[model samples]
Target: MELESPQRRSTMRDAPWWRPLGPRAPWVAALLMCAVLMSAALFIRSTALESSALVARGMANVIMVAGFEAFRDADGLPDQAALDAFLASHREGGLRYVAVLEEAQPLVSAGAGKVGTRDIQDGSPLRVEGARARLIHRIRRPRPVLGPLTLEETRAMTSVGDVQEPRKPLRMVYEFEPLTALELESRSQRLLGVAVASCVGILALAFAFSRSLAQREALAEELERGRRLAALGTMSAVLAHELRNPLASLKGHAQLLAERVESDTLLAPKAGRVVSEAVRLEQLMNDLLGFVASGELRRVDADPNDVLRAAVETTGSSRVEVRYLPSRTPWPLDAGRLQQALENVLRNAVQASPEGRPVEASVEHQDRSLVFTVKDHGPGIASGEEERIFEPFVTGRLRGVGLGLAITRRIVELHGGSVIARSHAGGGAEFRLIVPARGV
Candidate 1:
């Protein structure tokens, strides 16, 4: 009954900046965490591959230089056996192919079958392609004059009037193994799978936590609303009890005065007005008592159609049309309480409609629940007031106390049912009372 002040309403409307994001904060935090984890995983994988490639390149260069040193014999001539022995010792170190070249001609080579044309291209002397690497080295060839010809001996021979021809350059080509590259890729792919699976698990947990939080908040709001309504009901019951005797006395005195003043034209009209207003106050007191006592229920097996007909009869409006389901089965219900609730809803529908328009009523069974629908050919509920109209002391019209729909909702809830209100497409309002048959 007390209206809210404009200052309090304005303060509520001006909420904090972050209030809009409060409900979605859980999802936002989860997505940000997942993004960070995925980025770290990808960075680590790339770094690991880069480090491995660097190691492979260094090893290939070392093997190429070592092979060139071992290819020469004590007489300063090419030795096939020494080169072959060196390759055999380091084969497990990813040195899959090796070749010695003179003037672009292959002199002696090992593992030549595994080398492809695409593997050897014109590039830097020491280069790496993925997990594989290549290295080229050039070595000097000394002409032999004796069992072992030193650099000084060769120079003396050339200076003593003995001219010598220049020697062709020898080059070594090395190709690292492919198996090492494949193994690295397989390990990285496994790590990627682990990252994806972890993110999925975390997303599931976040969704579950958000859902649980929402349910908890809803229950808390419901408890607070119940507390407030309990206090209001207690005060209402006290006021009704205190006002009843005085109201009855006023109604009786007004009626007696009206009978006595019937011969006087103006006095009779004034006295009648007092009696009518007193009667209206008495009805309000009765409604308050009923609203306060709506929590208790007494269930009995009874026919719902009979209850529907009784409510319609109480409305006593000629413009109302009834459509009842053919089936007549008994359900566990508080006949008196349910009929009272139905009567209130039906009367509201009848009163809201214009004089000539008809109010429609129907009953049906769905999913083991009974549904009672009432539609009035009225202006219908306002855009946002459909829910607020069900609160006690909240009304669209100026006349009468607004306890009818509120009391109806309380009684329906006690019967394990719900009330839904919606504006019909054809310019009216519709209300449905869905009551479960078994659970109550």
Candidate 2:
């Protein structure tokens, strides 16, 4: 059977759409949030600026129209002085140029001088460049009022250039910077700050939400693993209790039959096979109990070298080689449990090695931890199976259940340590049991 990483399996079986992103979910969400929020801010800023420009344009037209009517109702022609005064009064409103022209020649003008005849001949009513704007408006004479003329009105009409002077199709040209004229610099700055602040705040919130979701999923998976292990332990206890007596009786009868039928060759071999199978079953039962055992450690000050020696002796493999580096300092550990863990790993290495090949073992102090290593001259663990082989009932061998490494890992972790398996560079599988050298 094929096995995969627990996280990948969990994600495939029952995870949210974003569960596959794992630790990167927050970053991904933050990027997407930034893109959307910045886009919105830019759109709003552009819309507001457009609206402001239109309002400024309308106000300029109103002021210019009022001035034009005033010049028309005066007693004499509006000279350059009057036009200059009109422009200066409205300078704060962004008015840079004002002129009254007849047939492309300036009759009166102020601010940046009169428009060029060539520019006027071009016939474009309005021209805009960056923040500056120019508008050309044709002026119309006010019609005579229906009531009897007042003394001031009659006197004004009787001037040298009378109301009868042929209406000169007069044109007024204006140039100004609308945005700067209306003093929108501060308002634009405030809008920019608000936009930037809004985008950052929203991105932060999105990142937080993503992190919280990932954490919640991780907790749920952890709880599920606890439940499965709890149920397995309960079932293993019940089966061990119920099967022990019958298994013992069967092994006893098989061994007695083998002894009595020694002279009967055929019957003797059959009985021998039965006893061997029973022994194997007994070993299987022992391994099962060891795997489902609790993780509580009983710690004591013990020498690691002594523990390694004991494990090698108990394994009883003549081909096992030791590379012992004795440590002068004693380490805190549960000697019996640690010995058992080492023996399990050593026995597996011995079993996997070729006939007459040696299984190597070593122990040494590195930094703040004690490390025990085992290497077997056998076909190494398959690719991608290094971590999976540590899971309960996951064996790479044709014989025996796969609980040795799992038990070893559990015992090591109880000491606040870890176990890792990898293929040796030369040719074999290597296992390391690294544990803290000091008391927990």
RMSD of each: 6.6, 9.0
Q: lDDT (CA) for every model shown?
A: 0.81, 0.81
What lDDT would candidate 2 get against the real structure? 0.81
TM-score of each: 0.77, 0.70
Best by TM-score: 1
Off by over 4 Å in 1: 1-21, 72-84, 101-108, 122-131, 136-171, 178-198, 382-386
| Residues 1-440, model 2: lDDT tens digits | 98899997886888678767875777787788778777776776776677667766676677667676658666455678888888888787778888878878987788884577776777876665566677787776445557888999888978776756466677878887775434554476577788788778877887788778778878988798779877877887678768877999999999999999989988999999999999988877777777777777788888888899999999988888897774456888999999989998999999889998899999887878989999998999899988888877778678877878888998898889999999999788999999986553
Itemize residue pairs with steric clashes in candidate 1: none
- Model 2: CA > 4 A from native: 1-46, 49-53, 56-60, 63-67, 70-84, 96-175, 179-200, 262-264, 353-358, 377-384, 424-428
Backbone clash count, each prediction separately: 0, 0
lDDT of residue 381 for candidate 1 = 92
What 10-residue stretch in candidate 1 is worst by lDDT?
A: 112-121
